[model samples]
Target: MAECTEESTMCDPRHALLLQSVQSGLPLVHRPYAELGQRIGMSETEVIGLLSEWVAAGIIKRIGVVVRHRSLGYDANAMVVWDVPDGRIGDVGRRMSAFDFVTLCYRRPRQGDAWPYNLFCMIHGKDRANVLAQIELLAASCDLTDVPRDVLFSRRCFKQRGARYAARALAAS
Candidate 1:
């Protein structure tokens, strides 16, 4: 197998082909791995085995699907950040996450004065009014009505995709 290093711009040819095949997005088939393998002259087992090896070796970090929420009519997207007391953050975050409207939630360190908020959650809805209403509901239900928070609505959609290892490797080749 070929080796890739920080100084080396390329990787194994087979791995390069496999990465290229998946970079665009996996096929919408019952057996996507098998389809990927067939496209690159590899067997389903070979594809799965290679992916496993790379993962164990720390060559691949993660594999996940990127959903296009706007295409699904979820036009209003807001990231609601809050400044909860350190002692209450865990409880508040948990309660906030329990809501079906909150698709994502996590915590971050409060930036001194530049940014005071810590806990954060994402809410997506069909319209801005609905999203704002949901935020109000979240604040009331989570006992966060007194918390200092901000609801930032996205004004633009960014291209969502996975890593581009194949592009770099191909450029080097």
Candidate 2:
């Protein structure tokens, strides 16, 4: 896999445009990208090509939606952090990611004395207690009894979307 860098050539004009469109997300319309392309002075085919190229060049990671789970009746969401041994981190992370209940899982950099967890997982449920129980079951199944973890429940959401690329156009101009 190509490593992410700030000065990568993949951050070209088309890539920038694709980033802007992705950050804005698909509009709630029958032809969202086509409409978006019209607004941005490009055809839908061109936009799709840009996205495909960006993905090929590893400039963009993944494109997907961020559903408003709470509004959709999913009231519970928790960030579960685990401190797995260095050798087992990959194994544990893969296992967690394979679980349907585990929506997101990755190894984040460990904070100093405050936080030592490296493996992080996000779980969603209908309620807080249900989510907690699910986490406990997951831990047990993974034979992670000795693993130290903490559950951070979200209380509020401010903004959730991809990055904007309008600034790139402005900079070019």
Give candidate 1 misplaced runs (Cα > 4 Å).
1-23, 29-31, 38-42, 46-66, 163-173
Which residue ranges in model 2 land beyond 4 Å of their true spot? 1-9, 53-65, 165-173
Q: Considering every candidate listed, which one attains the maximal TM-score?
A: 2
Q: lDDT for every model?
A: 0.86, 0.78
Q: Give the per-residue lDDT digits (tens) of candidate 2, residues 146-169.
A: 889999998888875566545546
lDDT of 1 by residue, 1-173 (tens): 44477774345788788877877887899999999999989999999998888789777667676778889999899999999999999998999989999999999999998899999999988999989999999999988899999999988866666667666666666
How do the predictions measure up, each by TM-score?
0.68, 0.80
Give the distance in Å from residue 95's predicted Cα in candidate 1 to where it truly belongs: 1.6
Error of 1 at 12 (Å): 12
How many clashes does the backbone of model 2 have?
0
Residue 56's lDDT within candidate 1 is 90
